[model samples]
Target chain A: MGTEIRVQQDDFSVADEYQQLAQESSCGAVVTFAGLVRELAEGQLDAMTLEHYPGMTEQVLADLVAQARGRWQLGQVTLIHRVGRLALNDQIVFVGVAAPHRKAAFEAAMFIMDFLKTQAPFWKQEHTTDGSYWVAAKDTDQAAATAWQDD
Target chain B: MVKVKFFAALRERLQCAELDIDSQPSDSVAEIRHRLLQQHPSWRRELLDNDVLCAKNFTFVDLQAAVNPGDELAFFPPVTGG
Candidate 1:
């Protein structure tokens, strides 16, 4: 019934998010995704600094969620993305979708993530011993997002 | 006046988050960028980078998109978020 979206610097509990989504009475399937900060170059990175357009970030996320809802009979979509400095292995993002059927839940979740990858305004900077550098958008990510444009 | 913003590495390079550009509703985004380059020659390469993307009033738009007064225009590198 309600979709939860958060852009914060604090850590989130996957179990708590899942518990809330599962409580929604008619939803039979819930699919969730957790993205973590990984080593950029075989342990060359120390941490990752994420930056975002504060005012526009929430707006863009809401639009992405709305698009997903339009395409699927979804119950609720919970999305949480962390900003600021994140250590290696720290969770960076979480996207959970609930639906009456497994297919809808799974497809909606994937669609949200794909769009988020290319459409969200957040940016990441990799920090290492030498210094830090902004992470460029991957060509592969662009391809993945583009695929969703088709029926 | 149009409110222009830069983000991510582009912001870091430009050392600016937001600025006001004197323009009209008939002005295209490309015109604004061209004016920006004239004022800040150092940003020409960064702003004109192939990967840079633009948004007008919170939605992504091409450089040729026209802008209206009070519109918010954003320029930044291709998003790398997930």
Candidate 2:
């Protein structure tokens, strides 16, 4: 019922987004995270190229948002993930959630991001000093996926 | 009938990431994957590994779903976007 659960690639303004999400009467707190493209990953990242399975990218994000919503009584959610080539320090992704309380908002946002890191169908090739290589799925990322295990 | 293509890690192993899949009248994502494996068994490592991703005309898909004969089908490794 809230203006939440959005996934897109276009530039977004976080300050404006926070103002909008916090305007609601039922929301007491809003939590947001802005992810930037780091210049290094395992000490090799000069620049990176991000590629995604177009249709599955948003679908997976939407699914993760839904999972977060199911776990917490969140009011609204906003997730923006950017694609294409990005330089160091560029904004890569954002996750913001609003709930009646900060706890739910914060946990849900973190949960969503954790799942996105591993589950979402977006891939990147890191430009490095030694040589460029595809970013492999990390053990931490796989372990994070266990959090949402419904079993 | 869109042309299907693969990139990055998927292409590195397969050497070629694209092919003209002459669509069957009632092709599903599963069938295309099987055919690709038939032609290139190394693809078997990536496809059934549970960490791979598949796309039909640039969109990810469930293997059981239907596909157009004239359409393209692509298989690749799971994504690792930040």
Candidate 3:
């Protein structure tokens, strides 16, 4: 199994990521998830700035990938998280998992996403005409992460 | 010395990204946090937020985690990333 993780400001090409992931023909299943920004709640937003601990962000992401590898029979996993300024509807993050079966690929992809929410060291600040404020971490996210412990 | 880092809203509130403090080998994350509060009492409210999270050497750690010289310690609000 292999893993790739990147934290950057530039946008990523989902098509290219998919094409590359599909090249491993031996892996019969590939699961991918992309998180996008929304313009809801506070009305139109100017932009969202994602701040992160440079070293820790990458470290934690790699650790998450390692954890996924341990839990499932993963072939290749790619995780990309965007930082810096982002407009509404912009892609925020991606988690892709490849495995020999759908169950492992699906479960591992979900696990990576679940842990990424509460464990990763990234923060979001939404900018609107009212003013910019840090987005609070939701209790539901913690619950989702915690639920995985029972698995 | 221990390198301390702050992130997210906590970073903005404290107006600090990083700092260095002389620390003892037996110092725990909580002890360092206490010392920081003593030095910058103004930051108490933000730093002491109930949901504030901590990490040592890029890994999530409890307050009781011991810190050695040259270790990296970080403080921040709970993560909001997806």
* Clash tally for model 1: 0
lDDT of 1 by residue, B1-82 (tens): 9899999888889999999989966899999999899889999889999889898888889988988889999999988877
Clashing pairs in 2: A5-A77, A123-B80, B23-B69, B24-B69
- TM-score, one value per model: 0.96, 0.79, 0.97
Q: What's the residue-level lDDT of A94 in candidate 2? A: 83
Residue-level error in angstroms, candidate 3, position B53: 0.6
- Candidate 2 lDDT over A1-151, as tens digits, reads 3645444556678998787778768889899999888766366577877777666677778878888878888886888888777778878888888899999998888888888887677778878888777888788876777765843
lDDT of each residue in A1-151, candidate 3, tens digit only: 5688999999998888887777787899999899999996748688999998888899999998898888888888999999999999999999888899999999999989989999999999999988898998999998988998998
Candidate 3 segments exceeding 4 Å error: none
DockQ of model 3 vs. true complex: 0.91
TM-score comparison, 2 vs 3, better candidate: 3
Q: Tell me which of candidates 1 and 2 scores higher on DockQ.
A: 1
Query: By descending lDDT, how would the candidates be arranged?
Result: 1, 3, 2
Off by over 4 Å in 1: none
